[model samples]
Target: MGKLYVVGIGPGGLQHMTVRARQVIEESEVIVGYTKYIDFIAPLIENKEVFSTGMMKEEERCREALRLSKDKIVSIISTGDAGIYGMAGLVLELIENEQVEIVPGVTASSAAASILGAPIMHDSCNISLSDLMTPYELIKKRVEAAAQADFVITLYNPKSKGRPHYLKENIETIKKYRNGNTPVAVVKNALREGQEYEIFTLDSFDDSNVDMLSVVLIGNSQSFVKNGVFITPRGYKL
Candidate 1:
């Protein structure tokens, strides 16, 4: 039977592509992904076809890959670790994903944390600010809960064109349970060059500083930055 590889391309750059992801991409005869993600891997394919599209087309994209995988080797690309808001879920939902192997990559959250010096050493919660799919009220509830639960929170897809107001709303929700002085860090384009990281108190976040490519980590009560590094104490090491 033909095989499929659900490869996470990490962020936007080729260098972030893991060795295994590269190997699988090199072996695949077809690559399927959103247009930008396809561009990230386009150089790796040797005359292989690429199928690309816009948002909310996950099922369509996965179906195309699944059909091709029935006869030829194929890989579906994602921007971050496949399990976290990546193609792994959509592909599995569309087909018997047992036919595919998932190749993990450096996730934005992990990369962001590494650059900021580990705000996630302790358990944290990740919430996407995009409420186009999930209800805004639900998003607010979850953010409030995370804040009340005293967990660090990493916000993904925090702002975009159509959903511009949600980031502020999310922050407001966090305020309901967290101090205005709570620690927050933003890491943009981590690991792939043009990377920018900022560590500051929650009260000072400039909304313009964040984008779709960024991961924003808000620390719990114990997180701190030292020697120019942001850290959340894990209580295990150092």
Candidate 2:
């Protein structure tokens, strides 16, 4: 039986991807992933067999990757850290006894945090606003808990056409625990093409600027903005 590698491409930029991730893709005989993720690594996978599927076809894609891995070295790719809201879990669940390796890469939260200065230097947690696989109530509970705990929070899949108000509602939930002046940062296409980011206060954040491609980071009570930089103090003595 051949081995399967789950690779994280890291925000769709070759520069952001790990060397191990690139090596696995280059060494694999077959590549499988979502259509957009496949396009991200198109340069490395030339002359290799690639299988791509669109959104919501994750099961089909994972199964195909497993099937091909039975006799061929297959690499399945996910955009930003395979283990974080990526294909690593699903692929692991579907495999019977296949040998698999998970290669970690920079996650969206890290990428966005870097662009927004030290907003996540203290304790932090990531929550997804997408309600497709998870119940909205559960997501809200997670958001509220994180906010109450004073953790710097990162919101993924923040807004889309169908669930436009979800992000705003969550922002209100956060406001209950955090002050209006709490620093908030929205990063779009982080570390990739057309990258853009803006810092705002919790109350002044404009949800209209966010979409599925954006990552929202909100600071804790102790966080502050100075010299155009968002920072959450890590209890340093300086």
Candidate 3:
């Protein structure tokens, strides 16, 4: 049986991807991923057979990768770390007994954090605002819990046209536990072409700037901004 590799391409840029991720994709005879992610690595896969599908076709893509991997070496790609809100879990769920290799890469949270200074230098948690696979109510509960606990929170899939109000609603929930002046950073297309970012306070953040391509980071009570850098101290004596 041929080996299957689930690789994370890291923020849609070749420079951000790990060397092992690039190596595995190069070794694979077949490449599979969402259309946009495939396009991110277009130069590397010119000679390899590529299979891609549009949004919301994750199951179909994973199944096709499994089928192809049964006889041919296949690399299934996801943006950022495959294990974090990516294809690694789905692929494992679909093929329980099969041996597969998971190659981790730079997740979006870290990529965005680097661009925004050290907003996650202390304890942190990630919560997705997307309710497609997860219920919104449950997502809210987690948001509240994380906010209440003073954990630096990184929100994934924060908003889209269809769910435009979700990010605003979560911001309100966080306000209950965090001060209005708490620092927040929104980074779009991090480490990729056309990247942009802005820092805001909890009460001043405009949800209009956020979309599926953005990663939102909210600081805890002790976080601060100085000279435009957002930072959360790790409790080191200085």
Per-candidate TM-scores read: 0.93, 0.98, 0.98
- How do the residues 1-238 of candidate 3 rate in per-residue lDDT, one tens digit apiece? 7878999999998998999999999999999999999999999999999999999999999998998888889999999999999999999999955558999999999999999899999999999998999999999999999999999999999998889899999999999999999999999999999899999999889877888999999999999999899999999899
Model 1 C-alpha lDDT versus the unseen true structure: 0.84
lDDT on C-alpha atoms for all candidate structures = 0.84, 0.93, 0.94
Off by over 4 Å in 2: none
- Among all windows of 10 consecutive residues in model 1, the one with the lowest summed lDDT is 89-98
Rank ordering of all candidates by lDDT, starting from the highest = 3, 2, 1
Question: Per-residue lDDT for 20-87 in model 2, tens only?
Answer: 99899989999999998888888998899999999999999999999999999999999999999998
Over the stretch 13-118, how does candidate 1's per-residue lDDT look in tens digits?
7877889999999888888999877876767975988888997888889899999999889999998888888999878877764488999988888878878887
TM-score of 2: 0.98
